[model samples]
Target: MMKGFSPTKYILKSFKSGKEFKDEGWTLDAPGEMEPSLIRAIYDKKQIDVKDDSWGLYKFADWLPIGRVLEGSSAPVTYKSEGLAKELGLENLWITFSGYWPEKGTNMSTCSFKETEAYSVCGRMTPEMDKVLVVASAGNTSRAFAKVCSENNIPLLICVPEDNIGALWFEEPINDCVKLICSKSGSDYFDAIHLSNIVAGMEGFVAEGGAKNVARRDGMATTTLSAVTTIGRIPDYYFQAIGSGTGAIAAWEANLRLIEDGRFGSNKMKLMISQNLPFKPIHDAWKADSRHMLPLDDDLARKQVEEIIAKVLSNRKPPYPIAGGLYDALKDAGGDVLLASNEHAHDAARMFLELEGNDIHPASAIATATLIDAAKSGLVKKDDLIMLNITGGGEEKFKTENELFYLKPEIVFDINPGEDEVIERVAKLF
Candidate 1:
């Protein structure tokens, strides 16, 4: 068993009820099959004090829920952006990047922030799981989890839309323990999700629990953890473009942990989350001052998904309204959703490349553009500390030096499949 690690406690983030179960691996009690409410791990940051020198994200082992992380794990890299700050007329702009920008030491070769969650999610798993983990993602997430599980020889079955399979590329061939399942009839991330749920019901497979997984939320929380450690205090406004808003929630969770640590200051950082236009579900909901999503309001949002520049920002159903999820995070942080046009994101990407000499993912460009708007609208002042999570970037640079190995799906299926046929195909791999 992995040693030198033990949870301080696991509690319902809403109820704060986990002091009753005083050990690791306790199942959180919940009603109905929705896995109940999300659970969070609480740690004594001082007693479990994280040594700053530990490489990558492991430096924050004091707060990470997982006992073990993959070897050579990477963390979100943060830096004070002089050029972009000057361009946007903001004096205190910090960039937290997670991708293959080597000079920044960002080694997440998937070129996505999803790797943060991947390492943490896989880290929490062990051989004793005895079941293959089934994950559904649009692109970046599937690629991130596949890369991490492959490196560690952990069993994973990834379900992704057929078109998004191209994004599931790695520098090396995938491990034999990992399997990719393509959803042929699936048109979007939601379709892929529908298919994966069916596959997860089989005898030897387990759903990775999309948004509800504590490991993922805590893992991505490291970006926030890294920012506070470097800035020496939480920023005034935290920014990121999110599909599921899970990253923003992770940031909020990490903020609570830092406050509890009693060393990272007490003020809450405001969240300025963004979404690309033509498909802004969360943005529309927040605009209407609603906690629960009003899909009828953004009916055109679904019709316009293909037109959006940032396809990854097209999560039709995010974990926003759930208890302890995005809505709670935004409310806790005094946050609002930022909306951007294709022109907005494109302009930001151009400015970033010209000024910073680095390319940002479209989703990240949306965030960058929103930050500029926030500054111009006087919502944020010149010297307010701001942390912009460039959730993913450096793809153009990464491709210049590396060869990508794209894996073909071992099985192609639809939302409803013959159970025996799916099982037979998967059993052969195990």
Candidate 2:
């Protein structure tokens, strides 16, 4: 269990009851079976709360509190991936990156796109909420949320894989509001998730559901919004690599908003979701055209995907086929699915570095590989408005400023454990 200082405020709301955001708004409805209307309704009804002054990092210069770009990034356009353009055979391909690399811009807070999601989520947290307890099963999201919470002094408790602590690279050390906890030995992200849920259910803690949280969905969705706004139109096709598939879902929601905004584009954009090799259940299931997927349920499949070494993109059980699953989202968008092996991802990253002169994280490399494959297969046109969401990059950006970061699993749980230890830990926090 993880304990942290109490926060002075707490904010809660749903997608439906937001403060009447009306800039060419689009309805972010999940598929009929996987409808997010309940959350959206909450947001619409003002159930979800945010500070009146809260504004996300993605807001244009006109909206930023400082009225200046972050230190490293000069403009959003430079962050977009360029190597992907030539390979895709598209004249106008764009890759929007967020980080502290001088070539683009330094999201000096580190963890790249994860910061994008965290900042947006925090911005929406009204002062009414004393604190926010975010359950991050992975290092990226954990570091991201921790960074934001530290900066804002928002009490945040992060639950992550025991093995992932001490391993993450960060823009800086976390603040007092941020606390990291891991499960016992043999525990993974899922186990921490279960434990985090129990604690959140207790008094004064709000659980930031990983993929299910609308703030995360909307926050990640801003990549697309930035794209269309920068280019003045929605690309004919949008693509990204997925771990939990939330970013893709966020893109879908953003597209809907763009359509509603009307100035960017009135039509829906086709989505192309990519999976790294071996654990590509979503890709395989989509190719099979099966509405439902039978679990691979084999360690071998997991290992095979792990060999690709793009560990961040590995989500054994992606939300697919169950209403808001990957399959349903792609099908509704008239999109396609792509799978890339580790070899492919690495090669693409190498080629991109040479062509575009920028280093990209391995997970995002998977998307670049898919773009190349799609072009070679002639699946996309040369002139299509193709936008590749380079979710992260600039591994070397902070090496000069600080040392590398790492994750060290704190506890070792065989499986589920008795509640006594967890309860005791929680009690100590107050």
Candidate 3:
């Protein structure tokens, strides 16, 4: 049995405080919810050890701030993609794939890395808060939470945009506790978030903290742990595509932990996070060397979000520029943001499918495309060890092999809905 398998304390990054804490309730460290903050797990290293192949994500349970492991191989699968390496002409290339590809044993039914956050956050909840867990997503995040909630018989409420309803698919029958509320066509991801927040305030509902959740952040850090344990060392560069940029922050935090663990080489890994063109607020902010994002004209941002192929990367208000947020993560890792256009994403997706024999999510394609740009621009040397986080993939094969049971919306509302009846309608789901 793994000793010290559960985290002992929660450290608030912004406050520079490391206090022993419990797993229940909201884990973010700010005095008030309005002041944004992030927290992490601090383990008892004397009893903790990340054993190799230790039954999925539980391998890093010592660091994950959850009560129990969800019954599945929830950790990301990491491997050195030789064919992709040879094609990209980089001598050392690792791919951390997080999606359904049973042949390789990476079975994320939602087909996105969002499931990592879902597992940890769901497990972190206190039984006292028997109220339903509420999550807002464009598609992947909500679908991930819904499937997991159904599997575990945990009550959950998913608020999502209507157009992306086609994205929510489950091989098994959904449980009654999983209720989906989708907004109309013009209602984008932010609309879904707005609605979810309103519901969160009402009785019998608890908000699933977005980037602020400690379990969610540490859960994502497993990707880095998976890579380090597999490769026996950290890579020179880390690549990923971000919406809320939480994953990149997770990677940086994981790197820091690994450095403290003294197993992986102590050198800092450079983050090469990317975004889809025309709608890249975080990317634009990084380019200007500014902590804050370029002022967003909501209408313009929405239009750009529509134009981008990677709809999952269209989070309007990301965690960037906040204290101990994405900006700090990038600064700590000596990282920079890269831009990938639609053409780049399309070409890269084709290249990945041909080379790796698996279909990747559009956001993952954008990350691969960013790698291509880096290789072409001489930003990365041919022999540099690189880790490409194929954040989501295997859609084509997954769809062909399994039956997709699309989840129907329990309630559909108009754009930016503000009726008191909406809250009453959601309350009835419990």
Candidate 4:
């Protein structure tokens, strides 16, 4: 452990078998899994004490499964909404803003909530571990990880789709310890994941276990922690746009913890999650009330991804069907999946800027559009307290404030490169 923190502060519990185990460096699953399940961090502290604002995201370190607190981190800023709430005629709408809005005291430099994952996942690392971490992303995640790893001097290898490379722009040149590799043009997030999986298996490389990592999920759970602590209680509904649906699952997990704390009321917030239209696998699966996703052809999936405005939400293999995943979270929380079209998402983005004073990501816009529809359709009552998680925003403002330097990929590989060829080329980068 890193000096002051204790590993015993939390235990990894298997979601399916109810088995608990200590953290063994990078434990993603239970020792002997009877069924596929998500491993969650069961923190020892039942009542969470928020640290000083100087701690940034570490304010909730009592709950996060991290060995050390990362510097320059910022927690989600949750406040009662005025502009959008009044426009929709809602009396108690709370917005949890997670990007670079200085006026709102939000400071996620990457302009994405993926920073929560990056900081906690990387913070879980110790000096004794000597392996390069491998991460895969559609865009936002890679940028967040790259920025964190670069600043912290942690060796990292990022695999992202070539089409989304523009999202890698940073305020300064990244450190040499962080190297990027791209899945060539026409590939999607799944292709990037495939390439990273092969590379992660190679010697001296460790996979940054995406949604499976307890640190990541617990880190994302901070969004809920921030909202509940700020709102003084759990909201009636929670809304967000998802690619992997991991954020919604994290929120559900946080709700359970807060309920156990005995301070927050024992109310399960309905998870009102949305997906951008045409590339809505989770939405389709949830709407059908199926634990398994309907078979989607590779070509058809890729075509749908191409048709969507929110490229970051183009995840082909989201953690929806697994035990203790999105499906279970939705069933327990009681909510429906909604869809937003590209045009409506664009309109919502503009409206958010005009009303909220900050531009949002495409995925966030989809979420806003869905919430608007819900309010207009009477799915949500006027006086009900609702939490709309603006997962990312303020990119346009950040761009105008800082000169960005884009990180160039160390190597670009075909969508499906041979394992030997990849191992050989990637090994040489170090």
Model 4 per-residue lDDT tens digits across residues 1-430: 2345454388888989998898898998789886889999888898999877777887888998877776788889999999999999999999998999989898999999999888888888876889999999999999999999999999999999998899999989999999999999999999999999999999899999988998898889889999999989999999999999999999999999999999989999999999998898998899899999888999999999999999988888999999999999999999989999999999999999998789999999999999999999999999999999999999999999999999999999998999999999999999
Off by over 4 Å in 4: 1-8
The candidate, 1 or 4, that scores higher on TM-score is 4
lDDT of 2 at 230: 70
Q: For each candidate, C-alpha RMSD in Å?
A: 2.8, 7.1, 2.3, 1.3
lDDT score for residue 53 of model 4: 72
Ranking of all candidate structures by their lDDT, best first: 4, 3, 1, 2
Task: Choose 3 or 4, whichever is better by lDDT.
Answer: 4
User: Going through the candidates in order, what is the number of backbone clashes in each?
Assistant: 0, 54, 0, 0
Error of 4 at 185 (Å): 0.6
Candidate 3 backbone overlaps, count: 0
| Residue-level lDDT for 289 in candidate 2 | 90
lDDT of 3: 0.82
lDDT of 3 by residue, 1-430 (tens): 2444553344433423433454446656655345555666666562336655545666777777766566654568988887778876888889999987777778887788888888778767755668888899989998889888888888998999998888888877799989999888876899899889899898878888888888888888888888887898989999999998999988988888888888778977899999999888898888788988789888888789889999999998898887768998888888789889999999999999898889999999999999988887889999888999988988788788887787899899888777697887887777
| Candidate 4 vs. true structure, TM-score | 0.98
Q: Select the stronger candidate by lDDT from 2 and 3.
A: 3
Runs of candidate 2 exceeding 4 Å displacement: 1-38, 41-84, 106-108, 184-187, 290-293, 298-308, 321-325, 404-412
